[model samples]
Target: MDTALIVGYLASICSVTSFIPQVWKIFKTGDTAAISAKMYALTVTGFALWTAFGVMRVEWPIILTNAICFCLSGLILIKKITRRAR
Candidate 1:
């Protein structure tokens, strides 16, 4: 109901879904040659850390969004690593 809370939700939704396209593209076409392993590794790690922090703080929005982001980034990271091995 507050403006800040509304903004937080909106921002979280946008950030959380931002990885969907990348994950979908990587799996759909099996093309991860251009995806940087370091970048995604850092991203997933960062999201996991943020999710933990959110959980510690008991912030539902942060926990929910970062958890989603962690999973999505983890998916991409996994795909990139596996593709590079082939």
Candidate 2:
């Protein structure tokens, strides 16, 4: 692959995993007080749009990266909502 594609992949990897630490912390500590529901909701919406855009353009890196991000953000959103419900 070319340098551009390699860079894209590297960037995607970083973007996708950036949420893992937050997820892990939330999971381990069960603390959603610091996590803003509105922020994550907006983030998930943005990621969904990006994933759709990548799908329309047939871009694997964007699609995969945004899809993973969407899921991660969705997980956080769900946790926040459910905790709020309780």
Candidate 3:
């Protein structure tokens, strides 16, 4: 593959994996106290929009990357909201 494509893939991988630690920490500790709900809300919305844009443009990398991020951020957002509700 080309250098740009390789870099894109690496960036995607890094982006996707970046959320794992936060998710795992929340899972293990059940603490959403420090996570910003508004930020994650915007993040989830942004990722969702990006995924839709990717779908419209037929770009698998963008679609997959944003979709994964959407789900991950969505999970964190959900946890934050629900924990706050209780």
Ranked by lDDT from best down, the candidates are 2, 3, 1
Worst 10 residues of 1 by lDDT: 2-11
Candidate 3 lDDT over 8-74, as tens digits, reads 6788899999988988899789999999999999999999999999899987778888999999999
Task: Score residue 75 of candidate 1 by CA lDDT.
Answer: 89
Q: Report clash pairs, candidate 2.
A: none
lDDT computed for candidate 1 = 0.88
- Ranking the candidates on TM-score from highest down gives 2, 1, 3
What lDDT tens digits, residue by residue, belong to model 1 across residues 1-86?
88877887888999978888988898899998888999989989999999999999987778889999999889888888888888
Query: Scored by CA lDDT, what does every candidate get?
Result: 0.88, 0.93, 0.92
Winner of 1 and 2 under TM-score: 2
Q: Which prediction has the highest lDDT against the true structure?
A: 2
Clashing pairs in 3: none
Task: Summarize candidate 2's per-residue lDDT along 1-86 as a digit string, tens digits.
Answer: 98887887899999978889999888888889998999999999999999999999998889999999999999999999999999
Query: Which candidate wins on TM-score?
Result: 2
